[model samples]
Target: MPTYISAVFNKDTRTVEFTADNGDKLIRSGGSLAWLLNNPGNLRPGGKYAKMIGQADTKSGKFAIFPTAEDGRAEKRALLRRKYNDMTLYNAMHTYAPESENDTAAYLAYVRKRSGATDQTVIKDMTDEQFNGMIAAMEQYEGFNAKPETRKERIVHATQVTLSDGARPMPATPVIVRSSNTGEKKVTTNEHGALPTFITRQPGEVIELFLEESGKIGSRIGQFALQQASASLVFARNMMTVGGNSQPHTPTQPSKEKRTPLRYVVQPGDTLASIASRFKTSVDDLVSNNHIRNRNRIYPGHVVWIYGKAPADAANDGAPATPTRSRQASYSVRSGDTLSRIADRHHTSVDALMAANPSISNANRINPGQKITLPVGVEAVPPSAAGSSRRAGNSGNPQTSDRPSLVKPPPETPAAAVRPPASVQARDTRSREGEGHPIAIIPFSQKRAPWVEHAYAQARKWAGKKEAEISRTINFHSELGYGKQFTTLAGSSNAWCASFVNWCLRTAGYAISSPHPYRARSFAADTTRFSQIDEPVFGAVALVGTSHVGFVYAMDRGRPVLLGGNQSDQINFVRFNPATLRYYVPKSYLPFAQKELKETKLDELAATDLNAALGIVVAKKAGDNTR
Candidate 1:
C-alpha cells in the first residue's frame, strides 16, 4: 500500500513535500487550508474521528495532522462510513460541508456529478468506484487540487564560474549551460540551483554558457578547468574583486554600548499583561527577554528582566511610578530604622519585606526618607498621617503601632534601581544563551516548601473538565497568557498537562522562575527545584518518560494513580505502571515527606514493585506530557 511516511517544507522552493513509504512524492504549495494542514476532509481538532486515529496535533488544537495523503484520504473515508452511514448523498454532503462554512450546493453538485449518484443515493448503497470518486471530487472542490500560479524550473550548470575580486565564491547566477556537442541539449540545475560537478579535464571539450535571456556566450574549458581529471573544476578563488579584499585582512570590530535590562521582582497578583502595562512594553517583549515559555507561570518573588523603562521613569522624578497607588501606600524610613525593626513592627518577616523590595541593596543599612513597600495584607500609616496623629495625641511619635493602618500598600518593587544577586546575574547570562534550566524563585533548599497535597487538591478541583468547551479551555490556557491564542476550543494546540501542573503548583503557592515550565520534561529537567526519589509518594510529580506527567494521587495494586490534565481529554485519575514512573518532589519538601504522609494518613500507599509493568503508553495530545 502507498503510505505517506513523512512531510517536510522546502524553504528554497516554498513547498511542502509529502513523501510516501513507496518512495513516491507530491510537492504542494499555495493550496487550501486542508492541503496545508494535511487534513483532506478539513477535519477540525477535538473530533472523535481524528482523536481515535491519533492523527491530530492536539497541542495546536487546530486541524488534524495526517502524515500522508493516504492517511488523510483514509480518515475521510472512515468519516463517511461511520458518520454518513445511512444518510443519502445529498443529506450527508449538506451536514458534512455545511452551507454556513462552505459552498454546499456546489459541493453536492460536484460530488454527485463525479460519483454519478443522485440526491436519493444512500451513502451505504454507493459502489466502491462511486464512493472513491465522491471523496476525490469533494477534495478537489475543497481546493486541495489548487496549484501555484507558476513553477520555477530548476537549472543545471556544468561549470561554476567565478567572478573576480576573490575572498569567496559568489552565488551562482541564473545562467544556462549548453553542450557544444551535436546534441545541443540545455543543461539542468540541481535543486539548489547550482551546477553539478560535471566538467572533466579532457581537452577540446568546451561548454558554452550564457544568461537565460542572452544568446550564445562562449566559454573555454581550458580557461577554468585544471589538467588533472580528479580535480573536476578549480576556479581561482582570488578572481572576484568587486570590493573584495585581495590581501589577508581582518574586519574591524564595531564597539557597541551595552544596555542593561531592568530587573523587576514579581509580586502577587502580577500577570504578564499587567507587568507589561506598567513597564510600557508588550508581553511579547517580556517573554522574549526572559525566554519565558509560559508567561503565566511566573510567581511572586520571581525576577524578570525588562528592556524598557516605566512611563514614569522618563520624567526622572523620585515620585512613585504608579501615581494612582502612591497615596499613603509606602512607609518612609525614619532615623535609626533598620529593616529588621521595621519588619518586626509591621508583623511581617524580614525576608518577606526584602522580597517585596528588590531595590534595597543592604538589609542592615536603610537611609532615612527611603520608601519601603510593605508585604500584602500588612498596612502602615503614611508620613503625613503619622505627623497628624502625633500632633493630635502626643509629642512622642513611636514607629510601633498597636493598630496597623488600613491603607493598601503600593507595588512591592517600585520603579527604582535594582541590583540582582550575583547568582541571579549568572543565571541570567546562561538563560540568554539557552543553556540554563528554569530557576525556582523559592528554591527547594528554603524552609518554605511546596505541599504536594495542595497540588493534588488543585488538580481535583478541575476534575472532568474538558477542552471541548471554548470558555473553560480558554481559562486553562489563560493561566499561561495563551488565552488570546485560542479563538475557539479547537484552535489551541497547547498540550496543557504541563500548564496544569504549573498552574496547580503556582496556585498552591510555589513559584517557578525563568524559562517557563511549559513542557512536561520541565518538571524533571529542573533538578534544582525537584529531587528524584526511589518510589512513588502521594503528591509527588510522576514524570512518565518525559512526554507525560501527573501528580501521584494514590497507588492501587502497586500501580501509581496519576491525577493530571488532558488524560482521556479531561482532568482524571489514571493508573500507570510503577516501572515507567519517575517520581520527583520539591527538594526541600523531601524532609517533610514522612510528616506529610502521616498527617494525610497516606503512609500505607503501595510500595514500588519492579516486577509490575505496563506497556509504555505515552499519550500525544492536547499538549499533554509529550516529548
Candidate 2:
C-alpha cells in the first residue's frame, strides 16, 4: 500500500501540496480548485450527497467542503455508481464534467487511456481495479498533479503514517487533536465512512485524541492517545502513556558543524532570483524550500527560508538579513539555446528567465539570434566565453571582442521628451495615456451610439485594475454576484473574463437577453443584441475564439487593440490578429457608427489618428503571463 506523506496548503495561490510514497511532490494548482476544497470530482454540493451526514458549505465560497481526501474520492465513486452506472464512459463524462465549463473530451480521453478501457464501456461493467483506475485518472485530469516540465522529476521526502487494522471503525465522530505545538482542534469523520488520518506530525510527539459523544463536536466522552515518530504511529486503546518520557526530547551533544535554519522576510521588489543570489544559492533552492508557486509574485511580508550556511553575524543574533539589489545580466542566444538549457547552464529557473524577459510568450520556442535577459543574480555568458560555439560564428571576423560586456539599462527620457506638445493636447482625443494593453487613452467617439460610448467609458474605468490572485476581483464579483457558475472556473480557465465584459455592458445600460451571460460565447450567440461585423470599429465587441471577450479600442498596424479583463490576468491592452477574431457590434449602434466605418481603410485611418492620439507613460506593469 502507498503511504500518505505530507500535505500543505498555500492560501495565497489557493493550491495544495502533497507528497507521494516515491518522494514525488504533487502540486494542485490552476484548474484544481476541487482539490483544494477536498472534492476530488468537483462534485456539486446541492445534489443528494449534500443531505448526507457531515455535509457542510464552504466558508470561503460555494464549493462543496469534504472532510478528507478519502471521503472526497469515495463520493466521486458513489456519484459515478449511483447516477452514471448505465451510461458509457464518454456519455457519462459529458454529463459529469460538462463542456460548458470543463474540457469534457480531454477528461474522457485521459480516463480511457489510463484505465485501458474504451469510451463505449459502461461504468457498472468495469472491474474493481479498472473502476478505481478510471476514477484516479479523472482526479488527475482535474489538476491533482502538476505536470513535470523536465525529464527527471525533483524529489522531496515527508513523514508517513498508517492506522492499525485493529482500530475500531468510526464514522461522523469528531476527533479532537491536541498537540504540543498547535493547540486543540476538532476534525470530524467524513460522511463517506472513512476515518480522518493525520500525516503532518513532528518526530516523537505525543498527541492526545478525544472522541466526541453523540457525534457532536467538542463534547468529549472518551480519550485516547497516540505517539508519533518518524514513519511510526502507535495507538493505545485506553488512557495509557505509550512513550515513557513525558518531557520533550532534547539532544545534549552538539554537532561539529553549526548549521542552523535561517529565514528572511521578503521585501518589496524582491524576486526569488535576488533572494537566492544574496545567499549564494540558486533560484531552484529558494522555490523548493519555500514552496513558491509563482516565482514572480512574492509579497512584502512573506517569510522565506534560506537554505545552507548562514552568515556569521546574522546567525548569532538571528536577525533577518538586510535586503539588497542584485545586479541584472543579459545573454545572447546561441545556436542550440533553449530557455531550459539556459536556466540549467546558469544557476536560475525557467520561470526566472521568463520573468526577466516579458516578450517571451513560449518557453519551448525561441530564435537563435534573440537577445535574452538573465534574471537578477544570474551571471550571463558572452559569445566568446561560450568557447567552440562562439568561435563557429565569428571565425572570420576579427573586430568582435571576446570579452563579456555588461547589459546597460535603458536611458531614462527627460520629462520634456514624453510630454505632448500643447497644440497636440488641445485637439488630440488620446492626449492622456495609462500603461498596458490599450496603451493610450480610450478613444470614445461621439458618433457611436450612446450605449457604445457608455460601454467605452465603463471599460476605461477598469483598464488598469488587476486580479489580486486567480479569478479574484472584489468589484467584478460584487457586480456579477458570486453564483454557482463561477465555482466551476478553475485552473487555466478564465472565470471572470466574460463577467468583466458583462459588468461593463450592464453598467452602461446594455442588457443581455441570454440566460448564461457569464459564458464568453454567449455574447456571440445572442443574435438579437449583437451582429457579427467584418470591419472592426471603435467600441465593438471582439471575440477571440470562444474563451475571451473584450472591447475594440483602436486599430494599430492592421491589428485591433482590445481592452479586456483577464488579459495577462489584468484589465489591459491586448492586440489580436484581425483574421483570428470575430468582431461584433450592437445592431442598434451599427447605424450610428457606420459613418465612421465607411472609411474604406478603417484600420489605416484609425492607425494614424485614433491609435496614436495618446501620449503614453508606463505607470505600472502587469506580471502574470496568462490570459
Candidate 3:
C-alpha cells in the first residue's frame, strides 16, 4: 500500500494522471475531480456543484493533487499513465465552476425557448371532443340541474377541464350542476375548488344567462376558454411522457441541501464498482449520474460525488470541506519535445495543449521552458505539500516572433506515447510461433488469444447495450493513417483489421477506456444486444487477405456468412478460413480505444474478393460465459 501527499499548482479540465508511491499512474479529470469530490453529489459545503456559470480570471485556471492508494491498489499504474496519453483531448483547458445568476438568466431563456413555453402559448384550438361534449351537456338537461355526483351518468365521460389559476377578478370558482328530476339542481365544487361550479338548466335558462353575461352570445368565447383549459390539461397530463429527461425543466444547480451522499477522490485503479461499494451506492447510480459508460475505468486525483449518499451519514464520514475551483493557463512551444511527450506528462494531448496555449505556433517547435502562457486553474493542495519531480525549471529563452510561440525543448521520442497499446500482447503472441511456414502461418485459436471462448461474455454484454432501433450488425471502415502518434491509445491493431472492429465498437457507446474490467470486440456493439441476428448486419467487417473483416449473416454450413472488404478488388464477403488466415473480431472497442484507432484511419485497405475462397465453421468453445 502506498500513501503520500502532494500539491497541484495548476490544472485544466483535462484528466490528471500522477505516479503513486508504487510508481503506478493514477488519473482523474481535472474538472470532474474538482467538481465531484468537493461535494460528492450533494448541496452541502463539500458537495454542491450545480452548474458551471462563468469563467473567472478569464483564464479559468485549474488545480491539482497528490495521488496515492494501495493499501492494495488497482491496475498497473502504467495503464493509468496509458489512459492519460490516450484520451487527453476529451477534456477542456478551462476548469468548470458554479455559474452566477447572470450566467443562468440567458440560459434559462434558452431553455424556455427550447421547451416552446417562453410566452406560455397554450395549444388551444378546441377539438371535436370538446364541441361534442358541450352539445351532449345541452341535450342532457331538459330543465333542472344536479351535481356531478348526483347525475354522474349525465357527464361521466366528459373530459375534465380546468380553469387557469391566474384568471382576473378572482372570484370563488363556480360549482358544477347537472339536470335533475326536480326544480332544485345539485351542485359540486368547481374545477378550481370553489362552489356553484357551473349552471345547469334548460336551453331557455342557458340562453338567458348567456345574454346576461354577454348581450349577444357567450358560447363562442366560453367555448374557446374551455378548449384552452382542456388543451392545457391534456398537455400537462402528457408531460410525463417526455423521454430522456433528468429533470422536469432544467436541473436546478445542485445544492448543499440536496447534495450527493458521499464524496470520493479517485484512487489509482479505482473502477466504478469499487468506488460505488465504498460509498454504499450502486455502480449504476454512479455511472448514470456521471455519464460514465465505461464501468471499469476511473482516474486518480479526481473527485466523485456519491449522489446516493445520505447527509448525516456523509457527515459522520467526516468528509473534507468544500474545495474551491479555478481555471488553467496553457503553454504552446516550438520543437524541442514533440507535443506527445509533453502532453503525456501533463496527462493531456498536443491538440489540447495547443488549444490551451492558442498563441503558440502549432508548427511544433519549442525551446526549453519558454513561457507559452497557459490557461489553467489552481489545483487544491494538501495541508502539507509533497516533493515534486519532472522535467521542470527552464526560464529565459529567445523568441523570434511576437505572435504566441511554443516553448521549444530538445526533441525526444516518447516511448509510452508512440508505443502501440497492445504491442506487448502482440509480441507475446508472435513469440509462440514455432517457425513461420510462409508469411506467419498460424491456426485459429492458437498463438495469442484465439478470440473464441474468452470473448463470449463481452460479446453477450455488448448485444444487450445496443438500442433496438439501430441495426444490430457491425460494420468496418479501414482507413489507415497516423496523425495520432506518440500517445498511448487503446483497442484495435497497429497495422490493420483489429483496429477497424475496435473503431466501430467505440462509436456505438459499448466501449469505454479502462485499464481493467473487460473488453471484447465481438460484443462491443451492445452489452445487452442479443437476438439471433438474421441478416449480415450493418457496420460488420468482411476481411479478404489471410486476414479480413466482415459482418455475419446467416450461418452457411455453420460458417458465419458475412459482408466485408477486400479479396482482390471491390468490397464484398468471401469466406473466413480459420485454417489458413487469422481474423480479428472485437467485443468492445471503448471510446478511448477507438479514439486511438481513429488516429490510424486508413483511406483504403485491401480490396474485398468475392470469388469463393475457403470458409470453415467453428463451434463455440466449452466454458464460455454466454451471458
Candidate 4:
C-alpha cells in the first residue's frame, strides 16, 4: 500500500505544499497543480502523478489536492496560531528594549525583573504562558499607559472577488463585510473588482464576506492572519434569466403563472452533454431552457436551468447528482471459458464485458470458479442449447466442432515434400496478402506527449482573452525571464502567431534554438533542432505556408485542427487543409513509432479510439464534419 499525501495551495506564496502521513513535507510551484486541475483528463493511468495519487482505483485513499471546507478550516486555524505567536513576541521586544546591539540582553533582564524571577531568564527559555504574564506585568509597571488591551493595531487587508464563471472580475458588485469583533457593514467593489482594505485587530478574527447584488447573496468566510495580505475569492450564485435579462436569482416559491425549474451549478470540466447525461435530459433541452448560444462555452459557477424535476439523489442546493448504478448479474467462469464465448452466450460484446469488469486485463484468460459481472437480462447458455463444441472435455481441452478454435495452429508442414523454385517462393512472399499486409496497431507512442500537454495547457490559460490581455500576459512572461526574444516579438505590432507558440513551448520546458524565434519560417527552417515529419500528432508544432505556426491538437476528416495563438486573435481551433501543412516538428521526448498506421479501411479502428489514444477532444461546431 502506498502512503497517501495531501497538497495545499498557498495562494500567498504561489506554491503547493504536500503533507505526508508521517508529517514530512514537499513543496512545488503552482504550475503543475494548475495544469492538473484544468486538464483532469490528462491524469491518465500510468502517468507519474496518477500513480502517486492512486487515480487508477477509486477505493485507493490517495487523491490529488482537492481542498474541502474542513481542510480550509484547519488551514485557517494554523494560520491564526502562527500569527498570534509572532505578534506576541513582537510586542514584548519593541516595548521593553531600545534599538541597540544589546537589545536582546536588555529585554531579557527587564522580563526577569518584571516577573520577579531569581533565576536568570531568556526570552527563548520562557514558556508561552510565562512570557504572556511577564508582558502583562511590564505594562502594569509603566502605569498601564500603553493600553495593553489594544496593543495590537488593526491591519487592513485587501482582497479581490470574482465570478467563478470564466474567472471574470465582478466590478462594482455590492458586498457585505461582517466581523463578529468589528461588526457588520456593507461595501462595494472597485473597478478592479477588489474590496476596500478592512481592518482586523488580531489573528483568528473570522471575516465573512457576502456578495450582495440585485438582492442575491454569495458568501465566503475566512480568517485574517499575519503575513497574509491578499486573497482571491470566487463568488458563485444561482444565476438565471428573468424578463429577458440575466440576473442572480435564488430559489423562490413558484408563482401561479410558473414553477421554478431545478438549478444546476456548472462545475469545472463539465459539458452540456455530460450534465444532460447525468440529469437524464438532452443537450438540446438544456440549451433551450438556458438560452445558451454557445453550447461549448459554459463555465464553472454558471447556473444552468434543468427544466425537469430534480433526480431523487440530487440535492436541491445544486449538488451533483449521484449516479445510478446499472443492474448486473454475476457468473462463475468454467473451464475453457473464453471472454468471447462468454460474451456470445450472454448476448454482449467483448468490449462491453471488459467495461463491466475493469480488473480483467486479458480477454483471452479466465480462471475456473472466478466470478464476473454480466449485464442485466443476460443468462448462461443452457447446456442442452450450448453445442457440444462449446463444452470442454474432462481433460479441460476444448472440443473441436463447427466453432473456431482459440489456439493458434501449428506451423504448416515443411514444403520439402514438394519444394518450389526460389523465384516462385520469392514472388509469393512479395504478394500484398503476405508480409505486405498493413498492420493497423495504435502503438503507445501515439498518446500525447507530456510536453505537448504542458504547452497546450499553457495556451488554454490564455484562451478567449483579447489581444491587449494576451499582450499583457506576454509582457509578464518576459519579466519572469522568458528572454528578450519573447519581449522583442511581443513589442512589435505585427501578428504574434510565432511569439505565442514560442511562449507556450518555453513555459512547457522547451528551449527555442531558432535564430529568429519570432518568425514561423524560422521554425520551419530549423533543421538542426526540429525534423520535418509528414503526419501530424497531438502537440506537434505545425507551420502553415511560412505565415503561421500552431500546435496540432486534433484531426477532422484527415485535416489537422490547430490549437494555437493568433487564431482569430485568440487561442482557438482552426481546421486547415492537409495540403496547407508545410512542416511538422515533433516533441523530442515523443518520437514517432513507424508513423501513423496506414490502414486503407477507416472501420478497422474507431475514430473515437484514435482520439482517445491521442487525448484529443475536438469541439464540434455547426457544419463540423468531425462530429
Q: What is the lDDT of residue 547 in candidate 2?
A: 76
Which candidate has the top score in TM-score?
Answer: 1
TM-score of 2: 0.30
For every model shown, what is its TM-score relative to the native structure? Answer: 0.33, 0.30, 0.18, 0.26
Backbone clash numbers for all candidates listed: 24, 6, 129, 0
Candidate 1 C-alpha lDDT tens digits along 96-179: 988987788988998999999899999999999999999988887777756535432221112232221111111222334444
In order, candidate lDDTs are 0.47, 0.47, 0.26, 0.42
Once fitted onto the true fold, the runs of candidate 2 whose alpha carbons sit more than 4 angstroms away are 1-463, 469-473, 482-484, 487-494, 593-596, 599-626
**lDDT value for model 1:** 0.47
Q: After superposition, how far is residue 540 of candidate 3 from its true place, in Å?
A: 7.4
- Where is model 3 more than 4 Å wrong at Cα? 1-338, 341-480, 483-546, 578-627
lDDT of 2 by residue, 1-627 (tens): 322233333444455444333323344555446645567776765565521211212333344445456767887888889999999988998998889877788788888999988989998999888898998898887765543332122222222111111111122334555655555555443211122333333444444544544433332222222223112122212111111112122324322332234555553345788877655558887787666667765533245666543344432211223222334668878787766557534423444466577797665568888888775434564343222321112111000010111111112321111122111121111111211122121111122322333333333333333455323423343344333324433334435667667655544334331323556775665442345666777667788888788877656677987766666555555677888788775433443334446753333223223212222111343462337
* Alpha-carbon deviation at 230 in model 4, angstroms: 56
* Model 2, position 185: C-alpha lDDT score: 58
Residue-wise C-alpha lDDT for candidate 4, range 1-627, written one tens digit per residue: 112233333333444433222222344443332232222212222222212221211122112342222332233223324333444444544532436533555555565666654334444556666655664454333232332343221223223233211112233445556565555555554322334433223545565665554544443422332113323233322221112221223223322222235555554346899988765568998998776777876543345666554445442221222222223568788887766556534433344466567688765557999988763323343332232221221111110011110111112221112122111121111112223322221111112232344334434454344456656534422322223323432333445677567655543334342324556765654332344555665556788877888876556576766766666555556677878786554223222211332321111223343333223354543565321
